[model samples]
Every structure is written in C-alpha cells, then in structure tokens.
Target: MECPNDHILLSSGLKGEEKSYIFRPRFNYSKCTKCSLCRDNCTENAIVMFKEGYPFLMPTLCSGCKTCQLACPSKAIEEDRKEIGLTYVTPVNNNLTLVTGVLKEGEERSYPLVLNTKRRADIMDFDLEIYDTSAGTGNHVAAALEDSEFALVVTEPTPLGIHDMKMIMHLLEKLNIKGYVILNRADLVNDEHIIPDYEIIGSIPLSDDIVQSYVRGKPVVDAFPESDASVELRRIMERVSELLW
Candidate 1:
C-alpha cells in the first residue's frame, strides 16, 4: 500500500485538530547529474527519465517514502508536502463526539487519511468508540476496523448487498474479528434469507421516518423516537450490549 506521512495541527475549530499531509519528490535540476540513481532506486516505479535526460515523477504512483531523495547521489531530489485530507473532531453533544476523515477532491489514496483519523480518535478519552467504516472491503476499511472487538455487519436484502456482505464477512473472519449481521430493509424481500455461521442480531424494516431523519441530518433515534426503525435499532443495541458486556 502507498502511504506518505501525517502531522496533526491545532485548528481554530472547537475541541480538536486537523491533520493532512503527503510528501512528494521535487527535483532541483541545477544539482541533478542525470545519473538516474533516484529512478533506479524507486520501488514504486514513479520516476521516469525524459529523452532530454531528466527524471519526472508520476504523482499518483509515488508512495511518498522519500526513497528517491535519499538515493539521489547528486542531492537533486527535495521534499515537497501536499495536504491530502482533513481530520475533524466535532462535539456532537455533551456526551458524544464525532471524528471524521475527508480526502481532498481528486485524491486517489485514502489509506493514510483513514490511519490519521483513527490515530486522532485513539487519543481521545472515551469508554467506547463506534467506528463507522465506508461501504467496501478495501484496505482503508480494514485499517478502520482493525483491532475492533466486534463488528456489526449491516446489509440489505438485495442480491448485490448480500454478495458484498459475504465478502466483508470473509474479510472479518480472516482478521479474526467476530461479527454479527444486522439486516436492514428486511421487508424488501419475502423469501426466507439466512446468513450461515453468523448470528442475526436485528432486522430493521424500511421506514419513511428514517429517510426523513437522514434528510434532516439527524439520527432516527433522536428525530423519531416512536418510529419502527428506532425501536428495532434500540433492540439491536441492547443485544450488542449484552454480547460485549
């Protein structure tokens, strides 16, 4: 996996800091001897020599390890920093906090941002931390869920959803992380669907109130306490509490 580096800075925002950084190679042509040492030593093959006898970097392929800089015999390579993402800590309420990682637009790499976000959250004082990972089985997702005591594998009743859910479950098994399934939008399918070798903790039917809560930028439990989704979610939480505690 390609990774650069990270640094946390105190932002003007409330109760937290922002971290965003990536290192790239900058060539000092005046000092370059065109020996191709930097290109030769690059493990990622990010450097290429022009017909004019100079090296250029493909930023996307570079791992930003500074290997080229260190290997340059003529001291031509220099360090360049770019902000790739932002990590934010927001006060959700008196008892809750939210830490989010956002990658810059057009940035392809997300593993470093995920790592920095997790590091930021790990430093805060808390009794429990609920990590909400993006929908995928990529390395970024693995990094986010690594070291978690257990995971709630949320999935829908659609065919694509079930297929992807199984892939995620396989990943969790390989990571030695225990997992339980939560069937979301369970009313969409009438057939009896069951996940083998994993317990189903809850079944939540699709509800309009849940959609409204999403539109209003609030949690369903807070926005619609009496809604069916909210009730089912509370039961799921109780089950998880019993399993963990």
Candidate 2:
C-alpha cells in the first residue's frame, strides 16, 4: 500500500505482540536505488541512505511525519495505511454527516483508520458533527477525539464501566479536553461515587423503548422526543453546543 503522504512503498512491519500486533512502515533505503530524492525531501532525515548504500529509519528517533514521501521519485517508499482500514462517508441529514472508519477484519491497528476518517471530515464544511467512538482508552479513541471540541462519553452503570470511565476521564483531562458523562443505565448503579461537579450530560435509563428505537436504526431524539430519555439527550446536546461555542 502507498503512504498517503509520500505515496511510496518502502517497507512494512508489525508492532506490538502477536495477538495485538499492528502493521506499520519501516523506511528502508537498501531497497532504495540511490534515491537522493528521499534524502532531499525527507523533512525528518528519517530516510538516511549514506554513500555506502545503508539506509535505515529511526522511527522512534523519527516521527511518523511524511516529508520524505513527497521527495521520493522512485515511489519506493510506502505506508501501511491500507493495513489500517477503510473510511466511509455516510450522509446523516441536511445538517450533519456521519463518517466512520471500520478496521479490516483481523487488523489490530484501528487508530490510523480513525485518523483517516477525521482527516477526510476536516476538509468538508458542516454545521454539526457527532463522532461515536469505540469503547477503550487506546490510540484509536484518542485519535477519534483529537479534533473534537468537546466529547460526550457514554457508559453503563457497572463497576467495570465506572472503572474505565475514570481512566477515560483522566485521559480527557490530560488531553486538556472537556467532556461529560452520559449514564446509559443510570438507575443500575449507586449514586454515591458519581462525581457531583462533573456534568451528568444525559441519562438513558434502561428501557425497552430506547432499545427498540436503537434496533430500528432511529435516533432516540427522532423516535421519542417527548420521552425523558430523548429530552435528556437534547439537553446534553444543548450543553455541548454551549461549551463548543
């Protein structure tokens, strides 16, 4: 696969353990045919092909930044962008669009796909955008929330959910982004540990109505606007808009 920025096919490799490995690129110049182009154009000096014909990428020493790709004439350098996944743009309504990045099956790296989707969305003009991120405090979630002005984290009321919520909240705070919590099944958990100052942006009590609407691919706001759950969602959106503006 070609690197999105450089459009070159240099090298590709896996990161992390076997069960959780992700495909990434390793820029190799030994495969390069004396391409001074990669050297001249490399912004990070990541592609260092010496006169003796030894080329190596200092990935840690190097940033994943793509300056060399622009300079390589041989098109020998490439990226693992495809190994990450595909991005799809689906029209939601007149005012909004839903852009999703689904990882190819068996692929372990989901962050690049999210990054690609966000990049595609960034160029388009839109009045409102809502990103439904995957559950986790990993690179994928980080990338999904990167450009968002505000985030609404949804969680169920369970011990595990609360534990993960705290971790996610810490991550948001570290990123210096403001976010609110939406308790998906608010009545299930005790209220003693719930943070008082932290905004309880919305609540959707466990209900057959909400589940039926979700199964029908309908937004709760559209299906049951008068319902308490729908009302809470709107209130949350309003609060989010206020913070964003």
Candidate 3:
C-alpha cells in the first residue's frame, strides 16, 4: 500500500518544539543487505543493527523522509508499491454489470484494486450501482465501501467465517454504514449468535445446483430460480429493489 508520506507539522508553544508525524517505511528484509549503511544514515536513529549486521527499522521513531534510502549504497530501500492486482469490468446484461478485482498470487494489498474497480463502475451510466467488496475491515475494503448507502456481508457458518463476519460488522459500524448479513451454507450450522445483532437479509442453504450454475457459467438465480439458495438471492434483490425505488 502506497501511503502518502506527508508530514503534518503543528506549532508547539511550550519550549519552541515542533510537532510532526509521518508514516514510516517498512523494510523488505529479503532485499536488504547486512551492510548497516541505512542504520548509520537515519537521523532519527530509527534503524537498529541486528547481530547479523543487518538493519531493522523502528517504525515509530522513523520519519517519512527518504534520507536513509538516499544514503544507502545497495539501494535496498524502496517505496512500497505492490501493483499486483487488476480491475475487471464485464457487462452481465444491459441493466446488470460486474466490476471485479483480483490480487495476484502472493500479493497482500487489496485496497488499490478495489478503489480502481469502484472507479470503473462509477464511470458507467446506471440507475442502481452495486458494490461487492472483498472480505475484511482493512483500509482496502474501506476504500471500496466508502460513501456506500448499504452493504451486505456474506459469510458461511464455519468458525472462521463467523469470526470474520463479526469483524466486518464492527467495521461497518465504525464507518457508519448500515450493513445486513447473508448466511451462506446455512444447512451446515445452526449458529445464529454469530451475528445476533445485525439483520439477516437472507440465509442460503448449501445446494449442488448453486455450484452447478457456476460451473455452467451462469448465475444461480438465472439458471435455477426455484432452488432454495436462488430464492433467497431473489428475496435479497427484492429488498434492495424496494430500498432503491
């Protein structure tokens, strides 16, 4: 994630002190050589020397200034720019469009891709724009769901799924965005306490037809409208349609 490393300078009154803060760089240990050059050059004394002679950063004390990067002989210090994701826009129908983003294998950052994909959707002329954000409450998901009127968080009934569902719910509250839950694989468990506080838009039971529709390159609602999961999906759509209209 490329954070804007700008320092906020504030006036200090006590003893002519200046208050400033900035986001420091996180070093890539794989690329860094144990030369200790970066540690020696850091004016803030943020970098400490390891027993192996390699330098590690103390993020709190480090300023956003690139003095260490400029002074390093090996050029090991580099800006964090993980451009390993792509935004995809596909027209599902005249009324429905799908804008998706996928991070490349081994890449962890997801916000940029989400932001880019949302920008693509914003450009299109449509009455109701829907955004399906990636899981988690990280800044990436926040970037995707910013300014959204409503959000639907889908989760399974497993332990991990329930844990993550609570996490996203808290995040929705923090962002002041109203959210509803959709419990997938509902037949697998009977744990309603996982999301006791939030409203459940719909619960979709496990069904083979739902999987088959995906394999057939068709939406489950379009292919098997009578299925249990498909019916729940329609109910969700109807609720959303009512809210929008």
Question: What are the root-mean-square deviations of the candidates from the true structure over C-alphas?
Answer: 5.2, 10.4, 13.8
TM-score of each model, in listed order: 0.86, 0.66, 0.63
Model 2: how far residue 28 lies from native, Å: 9.5
- What Cα-based lDDT does every candidate model obtain? 0.81, 0.63, 0.68
Candidate numbers, best lDDT first, in rank order: 1, 3, 2
**Tens digit of lDDT per residue, candidate 1, span 115-225?**
888888899967788888877898888998899999999988788778888999999998999889999998976656544556889999999998887676567887899
Count of clashing pairs, candidate 1: 0
Better of 1 and 2 by lDDT: 1
Which regions of candidate 3 are displaced past 4 Å?
A: 1-83, 191-195
| Predicted candidate 3 versus true structure: per-residue lDDT over 1-245, tens digit per residue | 22210110111111212111233555666778777877888888988996876677776466456777877777777764334455555554466555556565555455555666667678876677766565568988888777878888898878898889888888888899888888898887866555567788788899998788767656677778899888888988898777667
Candidate 1 deviant stretches above 4 angstroms: 1-19, 41-44, 73-75
Candidate 3 TM-score over all chains jointly: 0.63
Clashes of each: 0, 8, 1
State, as a TM-score between 0 and 1, how close model 1 is to the true structure.
0.86
By TM-score, highest first, what's the ranking?
1, 2, 3
Best by lDDT: 1
Q: Compare candidates 1 and 3 on lDDT and give the better one.
A: 1
Where's the lowest-lDDT run of ten residues in candidate 3?
4-13
